[model samples]
Target chain A: MLKVNEQTRQFQSGITIGELANKYKPAADLFILNGFPVAADAAVQDGDSCTLIQKDVIPTPDEIDSFLIARHTPGIQTKIKQSTIAILGLGGLGSAVAGAMAKIGIGKMLLSDYDVVEPSNLNRQHYFIDQIGMLKTDALKANLLRMNPSISLKIIRERLTESLLPGHFSNVDVLIECFDDPVMKAATLRSVLTEMKTVAYVGSSGMAGFGDNNKIHTKMERPGIYIVGDETSEARPGMGLMAPRVGIAAHHQANQALRIILGADKGRK
Target chain B: MNITLNGNNKSIQEISSVLDLLKSLELTPETVVVELNTTIIQPDSYDTTNIAEDDWVEIIRFVGGG
Candidate 1:
């Protein structure tokens, strides 16, 4: 055990991240929402100034950091370093997913969203009013680059069909399903589940509301097939995806991807 | 009973079923994923997926973004 000197924050040795969350519930909620951890072993060095640290205000632990045990956990920066994911939609869920894939340091991303930003999208979509007429794939590209200049992005602006998807899925490790039409989404899922032989995971998302919710449904089929949000969850004009909810789903998808890449048992996740 | 939920330990009533515990997170039946002791519990089965005192659960969300 490390000693916490006068300069140290309150000592919380050997406390699991979650236990600390309970001790500081508000902070914990924030951390969980943001995908941070509550690792109790984290030390505030003597003489170092500190502030209240809410452990949950971040994404899942990608690698074991100083606060959390350092494992090459899949979603930590490491898995993003090791894998490639193909995102199938670039609207509400797709844009959020793409932005997250870059911010979290995923190695490569193939983004496909045939839609264009509309004046209506400004309310919930991440795009700016200035980007209103731009194709979603292009707008997303510009936005993602701003988020992480080093990310490798492959953009496809055309609406994709089953045939178009296969060529892209060629070397992809994971598939993120987020199509606009329910029938198309189902078709894409079925196609990927059948044809993408090398794919280990497929993550789907569906969120349509103003609030950033921590609530969403994610699926991991056959180890690598994962889904986030409800692809079929239709968003009404005022109820389309808000940043927080979309962000939460994006965070979870990245976490699952990192976990799988690390060989960390999905159960361990 | 003490068990882990998303890497943190918490004390739940010894008899709290997996479904009951999920209700505490305020996740809708349509959102949220529940993996109890490594198995992904289907939505229809969650109402009956009784969590053991020693079980480990990972609760994740699927929100829309970007």
Candidate 2:
């Protein structure tokens, strides 16, 4: 038995690919056997699935986007597009994480930030100069929607507290702690980890100064808590949070979030 | 008495409880999470949890930047 575009058909041994193509009378000159391109002279084996695509057929722009994304990482687009994540802060880390997740086609996101965009944020954050003075959540939502229009964004413009986390994160699959305050970060993390034990938490810790970039890492702090960065560097008076290292940490958090959602990252507790 | 604090071996005067340890370090208990002997000591329990000799304690605080 064979599957032709997911339909069952009787398997015919010794049938050349040319014979199968002729019998099917497909409009295209090429056959994709189980997602692999095959020539007309190739042998057709039993239990093979085939798809016929016209030679030199150009895919639409949107189709090309899907094809390229799926080609690079097969079976990830669908799953990523169905997963929901909640980003607790919308600063450099959260903003970049949101953009990265949206680009990967995450289904939905819950973004919370109370501050407005400032000129200082342009160095590493995902906002443009024109967006300065706009609420971080609104700006981030606009930016994410612009990239992936179909994404579901739940924007919260108030300061997040331990009390408010559970209510807002009821439907999210994972929690991302992107706050700039160590106090708030600890508070939010403790609240989420204790209240939402089932949800995975990806956080940033030590992304500061122009220190060793290689030191930045994603480590499973506990069973459900994952922290990215060196876990040592602190922003000091002379040292500052530059773009390169910050982006690295943000992407690390974002990547952790993606892998957790896809079941690719199982933390060692 | 001696205890391992945040991976560093520290020599401290005898302390009655986790709260005493935080007070000696000048750290407000509200700002950090304490892990004693590989177990997280909750903030509410810090006052009552006694500090034992050679205890492995991790004092984790938040990083202020993203």
Candidate 3:
């Protein structure tokens, strides 16, 4: 039995990937055996899984969804596609998180950022050089759409006050706090934890300078509340925000969001 | 009075409310969230929420970074 593009079929023993492609998908230009890319001449063993890709092919939404489902662990993509994540800031952490979630095909995202991209932000943020001077909300939305056009986005280009947090993110499954200001971060976390008891909250504390990568981590402050980072490294004049540490923390938050959405963080109070 | 702070047993003096605890720890109320036992203490109520002996308190302080 050989699984090709998520469909199982019986094939003659001693068949090669090229032969299988020629018989199953004649237009396939690339072949992947198991999880790694393989050449056309690669041998296709019985009970092996293979993926055939046609270059420049724009698959339909259903095809794309199927591909995602096939790539992820069993039943993971379905949960990922049904979850709604809200990011409160669009700075270094938020931008990277949004990029990760978009790549994973999150069902919807509520992104809020009041600031515009500046040259200073390019050092660590996900924005490109050309995106400078554009509102972070608009710029990030454009970038995210390019990555996954089918992702639904609701972007707000305004500073999020504590009063607005509940209303804006009332329906989201998870809320990520990526603000650069400590006051804003605390306020947002407090509001969400108190007002929106059902929504899982992932907030960042410290990802500054070039410290030990191992120091960055995810801590569940309580049930439905997670805080990522070293808990102490604040961005300052001497120790500035760098790409590697910030990205590490950002991905930690993104991963935590995924965990909450996938129900891996179940059985907590 | 003895209270659990961040999962560690600690003894403090004259800490009556969440605000007093923040003041004793030198953390500003604006930059930290106080969780008493398991209930999240709102910022406005920090001054009025009293701390009892052997209570579990988690004070999460935020830093200036994304």
Candidate 4:
């Protein structure tokens, strides 16, 4: 028995991958044997898994999903596909977080951003130069779809206030706060931690300046509340937001979301 | 009086409420999230919530940036 793109089939005892591809899927131009790319002449044995890829072939949604599952760690893709994540403030941090989540095949995302993509945002954000003047929600959605089309998105094109948060994020498994304003960050964190106690909250504090990357860290302030950053750096005159440092913090938030989804954060509270 | 403030044992002049505690630390109420005894204290209750001795208080100040 052999697994081919998640479908099991009985094949000859010792057949070359090229022969198998010719017999099973002749259109396949790329071959992956047991999770690694291999030459066509690689041998496939019993109980081995192979994924055949055809260049220029548009895969179905199920095919795309199956491919993602094959690439992820065993038994983790299901949980990732079932989780819904909410990202507030689609700026440098939020945009990068959304991109990472989408690549991991998150089931759904609740995205809220009221601002448009400006020229300055191109420096650190995920938006392209042509996306200038477009709403961050729309621009990010377009870019994310290019990565994973099956991801479900709920875009809110309005500023998030304390009163508006519960209605938008009450159902999400994890709520990530990515606002750039200090006041908004404090207010949003207070609202979610106070009102939505069941949601795992990840917030960012200091990702400004081209300082030491080691200074940025993910600290679980309390159970269900994680803050990632150096805890002191602020974006002001002389200390500005750069890509490398901001990307570090954004990926920290993304990894925390994954950890929470995979139950790694459990029992720590 | 003595209390654990931001994970540091600090001895400060006696204060009454959360607002007063903020004043002692020089932190503005609107700019920080105050958690007392593992529970988040709403901003509106800062004037009414009291800080008992040995209470674990975690105050996180928000700085501008993504």
| C-alpha lDDT (0 to 100) for residue A100 of candidate 3 | 98
Interface RMSD values for the candidates, listed in order?
6.7, 1.7, 0.7, 0.9
Per-residue accuracy of model 1 over A1-269 as CA lDDT, tens digit each:
21111122354445443444455433533222123332444433333322234443443333113222222233464555667878887765667667766766677898887788998667556788889899988888898877766668898878787667777776777677666555455556555555665665555556666443544766654455666665444555556656666667666766666666566634212
Q: lDDT per residue, candidate 4, B1-66, as tens digits?
A: 889999999876665799998897887788789999989998899999988888899899877898
Q: How much does each candidate deviate from the true structure in C-alpha RMSD?
A: 16.9, 7.1, 3.1, 3.2
lDDT of 3 at A268: 28
Off by over 4 Å in 1: A1-78, A210-215, A230-233, A236-239, A265-269, B1-66
Q: Give the Cα lDDT of each candidate.
A: 0.61, 0.79, 0.90, 0.89
Give a tens-digit lDDT track for model 3, residues A185-245.
9999888877887888999998999999999999987788899999999999999998899
- Cα deviation at A88, candidate 3, in Å, is 1.2
Clashing pairs in 2: A180-B64
DockQ of every predicted complex: 0.10, 0.51, 0.81, 0.76
Off by over 4 Å in 3: A12-52, A267-269, B15-17, B37-39, B45-56
Query: What is the model-wide C-alpha lDDT for candidate 4?
Result: 0.89
Could you tell me how far off, in angstroms, the CA of residue A63 lies in candidate 3 after the best superposition? 1.7
If scored against the real structure, what TM-score would every candidate get? Answer: 0.54, 0.74, 0.86, 0.87
Better of 1 and 4 by lDDT: 4
- Please give the range of 10 consecutive residues that has the lowest summed lDDT in model 1 chain A: A1-10
User: For residues A1-269, could you state the per-residue lDDT of candidate 2 as single tens digits?
Assistant: 87654445688888765677677645668778878888887778888877656667654446434643544464776777778899988988999999988877787899999999999889888898999999999998988877767668888888877788888885677889898888777777777556676778887888988888899998887766788989878777777788899999999998898888777886322
Model 2 misplaced stretches (Cα beyond 4 Å): A1-69, A72-74, A267-269, B1-12, B23-28, B37-45, B53-56
Q: Which of the predicted structures, 1 or 3, would earn the higher lDDT when compared with the native?
A: 3
Full ranking by DockQ = 3, 4, 2, 1
Model 4 C-alpha lDDT per residue in residues A84-195, reported as the tens digit of each score = 9999999999999999999989999999999999998877999999899999999999999999998999999987787788888977899999999888888888887778
